[model samples]
Target: MRGPLVLACLTLLGAEASAQEVVKIGHVAPLSGPQASFGKDNENGARMAVEDLNAQGVTIGGKKIKLELVAEDDAADPKQGTAAAQKLCDAKVNGVVGHLNSGTTIPAAKIYNKCGVPQVTPSATNPELTQLGYKTVFRLLANDNALGAGLANHAAKQLKLKRIAIIDDRTAYGTGIAEVFKKTALANGVEIVDQQATNDKATDFMSILTAIKGKKPDGIFFGGMGPQAGPMLRQMQQLGLGKVYLFGGDGVCTAELPKLAANVKTIENVVCAVGGAALDKRAQGVEWKKRYDAKYPGQFQIYSAYAYDATMVLVDAMKRAKSTNPAVYAAKLFDTDYEGVSAHVQFEPNGELKNPAMTLYVYRGGVRVSTN
Candidate 1:
């Protein structure tokens, strides 16, 4: 009698396992390059969301679903990003969560659209991304135009810096945000004293710094990511330009920036903008951060929360549609008005975040603190 009861329980467990439907969600990011830390944080966020959803035993369309995260490493390269997207397309993933850089995400977006897979970017901030008119594409953060203008306004109106110089890495994201900052700065009566271009991979910014130092500008705006911004700040300190204000868009804003600057005095002079509310300002930020910290352990970066929110948004659409089919829920994504941890997640007709929010930050005691 005891043996018969045990076998019956085992059969029920096997039946439940067989009945589970696996929903594959693709996540692409630079998991093995200069921006690997950022990529890993994003991957972790997506992974955690999948795990949580699985633990909750999500049931979609009358079937218990097991969420599977198919993560790919784009390596921060455009070619690799497209390859990753193609791989996901071939795998028939239900949705996608990343491609952290705008350079990577823009190219990958076309593939996702062609494949009819819904793609959501957690960190790419370039405005040109959504302008492609791909209904399948969605972004979770404010675009570069908002970030650039916000920083420019703060510089011109609050800080009252009139003489400024601009530098860009020439990437889609860097050049785009820098141009917007330039336009806004000029419109606000700020005089542009110098302009320079640098590649994202170049570590030595001494020549450019030396060139800009001669102009005696009150502020310097760099449009690049943290890997470049960190050394740029250190070189500024070495050139005795530590007191000059440093401004940048979301690309330059990161937890690793201070460490990259090697604790330089110029770190405090740095100001940057990210495309969302600061954690402290968000209603759920403190509790959400605690959960993230406990799960990832000291790995909170700028975009992980957005990545988590993006994952949730994607899953929420799936649940709303009662199906994991991309074709069915992609329409629901356009009508998205979900409350995300960062902001109320909604998309405009152009696939841009509705009423996107931008937050400015400054370095205080080696920590990036939000100003508003």
Candidate 2:
């Protein structure tokens, strides 16, 4: 009886091993530096998607497929991002789901495109990203044109601000949104009193704040991520600019924003636009956020859902084309219209999300809540 049981166990193990085929998906983000929190959140989202896909026993080409996530940290730098992209290409990942910043995504995109691996960016909202004509590149968010214009419209129509100052971190993501915002604001009859620049890693904003304060602007538009935005807010409070409305794009619209600022007054004055519908308002988003929160705990950031959706979109394309080969199924990505946690994931000819939703948010009692 013991010998028979041993033989059966060996047969089951052999069957399990023979039935599974592994597919690698690459994810890149700033897993180190000031943006580590965002990177970790994005990686967790990808990991969750891979786990869920495997649990469902996903099959491709009549073979059971096991999805694996290969995460890399670009530190939000363009060169490092390209290196990571090259590494992923060398490793022969079937698809990719990240490089969170536009600065990183745009450069890394060329590498992925050169290698014929499909790359989907979950965040990176620069309009130029899609304009690069890379057939393998797709974005799952509204571009800077949408976010910047939306914020400018809200500022002009609702807030009725006359004079505005702008500050950017000078990265591709930062300068791109600032340029759009400036253009939109100027067209809307708002005066551009001052323009300033800062690096993403800079903590000292007093020099720029002092100049902007001298200009007596009614509002300040910051083009950067939450790490810079947080400290900038604190410095604004110190410089007596707390009452002035602080506006930014999706870069600053994180749950971590208020905590980073630690100045409830300054945070309360912040209005940021995110390139997606508010999770609480969408039925699918609400349910998805619940599951995400359950698994990730208090680590929910803006792009996690997008990252999850991007991963799903890649897998969906593979399933539809019935192949995991990047070249074989990448074209199928163009025809996708899957209902994801974020939205109906469809793309235009330029690889931009079709009818992408944009939402404005503000801090209400120290919590970042959507105003849209």
Candidate 3:
């Protein structure tokens, strides 16, 4: 009798285990390249959400659900980004959380849309992303319009700079923000002394800095990531342009930028904008950041909070829809009203975050200090 009862109990346990549904959330970023730190930080945020979700025990359609993160490395390349998107789609993930740069995210958005997977990008800020008109595409932060214009306004109105030079890495993200900055600065009566372009992989900026320095501009704006921005700062110092203010968009605003700048005094001249409020100022940001620091330690960068919110927003939609099917939950994203660590998550008709906030920061004593 004991043997029969034990066997029956084991069979019931197996059945119960089989009853739980496993849901995959796809995350794509440049995990192996120059921007790997940003990518890893983004992935860490999503992973944290997955851990928290599973710990809380998720149920959808009346069945216990287990969440899983399936991350891919896009190498910050557009081609690889699409490939990662297709790979995630083929894996039939219920949703996606990234493709950190606008250059990558723009292309990946189309593939995810075709695959019926909902994607919320925590870092890609180019305005063109949402203009693609895919309902499955959502941005968790302010777009480049806000970031570029904000920086340009500050340069023209706040700093009262008369002349500014622009250097862009020529990626979609860099070019987009640079164009907006140029336009806004010009409109505000600040002369665009010179405009230079380079590819994303280039590390040298001496020639361009020399040219811009010759122009005697009050400021230089770089539209690119920290990898390029950091070395650019050091090179600017080498070129004796340290005192000239260096302005940039979110891509250049990172915790790693100081280290990348190699302790250059020019780091003090860097004034960059990020798409959301400073974490220290948000209601939940301080506590959330403490937890993140304890878990990831020194891995925190600009977008983790947004990435965490993106993951939570996706899951919230899934729960509200009571289904993990992308077709069902993707629609629910349009109705998101959840409060996130970064900001309150709500979407405009175009899938842009509603009333998104932007914050400017400068380095003080080698640490990122919010200016506003």
Candidate 4:
């Protein structure tokens, strides 16, 4: 009897090890603000990824498993990002998909790492986030290094702009991108004529534009989101500075930007770069985008596809490691290569995307037109 009982217990333990369990993936992003539309689109993309995974009847460790999403609103604020991260960590979730803004993502990275939960941000492009050397942090988005060079290359090689002016919002994402663009632009022979800073909530750019216009630059590289980009473009036109190209990072790449572009036709010459595959152009993304529209219409933000991929990466890593405990999976997460809707997924030693891909986008008829 004792021998039979021992064998039964062993079998049960083995079954548990091989069976699928409910895994919860967390999401942290700004759901409301001037950037609220961006967060909404990102969340929808993340939701679509989770839904697709659940629909597929995936087998994990020889047993059926499903993905669950635990979402929180970070409001694109640093304090809120930390709070949202602590909430997800307290929930003991297996992984987190976001905290979109660099300012928010930077502060929350430490919190997620401390809790032993891995977070993959789709849109936060600041270099400092990965510089901390935390093993639990990861970013799928193209960082400042890639984006800055792409813009500088465009300005120097394409636009042949011998001189350019630069501006930033001074947040982690803004300052980092601006600095990188300035550095690479200098290396590419695009002289940095003038540099200025602004706040995220600032709507007025008259003074900055006036000062920047004084230098007579061929282009203006703005390292900030759409809120400032729209008005700045308008003011540039107001000051009769339409000839200069208005450049920015993904922060300025959103569908909602056109609403603000009404007063500035010269925004047509605007160029913004993002590190993700064009959500509007992805094959799997096509269906996902349609479904997203059906569920939540007219909201297509940048990070959504990345957020979805982030969730899928976590689940796949868990399946490969055969453990829900992040410590073991975290070790294997570095090798994550899930072919996702956005693109083939993998991470580098710093937890950044394995191969950084940058897309240069232009505003054409108030739409994001990919010019390669």
Give the number of the best model, judged by TM-score. 3
Question: Per-prediction TM-score, please?
Answer: 0.97, 0.97, 0.98, 0.90
Window of ten residues with lowest summed lDDT in model 2: 256-265
| Weakest 10 consecutive residues of candidate 1 by summed lDDT | 279-288
Steric clash pairs (candidate 3):
none
- Candidate 4 C-alpha lDDT tens digits along 224-314: 9987788887888889998888888889977667777664778787888989677656788787677767887777767777877887888
Once fitted onto the true fold, the runs of candidate 2 whose alpha carbons sit more than 4 angstroms away are 1-9
Please report, in order, the local distance difference test score of every candidate based on alpha carbons. 0.91, 0.93, 0.94, 0.84
Please give the range of 10 consecutive residues that has the lowest summed lDDT in model 4: 58-67
Which of the two candidates, 1 or 2, achieves a greater lDDT against the reference? 2
For model 4, the stretches where C-alpha displacement exceeds 4 angstroms are 1-20, 62-66, 279-282
lDDT of 3 by residue, 68-135 (tens): 99999999999999999999999999999997999999999999999899999999999999999999
Residue pairs clashing in model 2 are none
TM-score of 3: 0.98
Report the backbone clash tally of model 1: 0
TM-score computed on alpha carbons, candidate 4? 0.90
Deviation in Å, model 1, residue 30 alpha carbon: 0.7
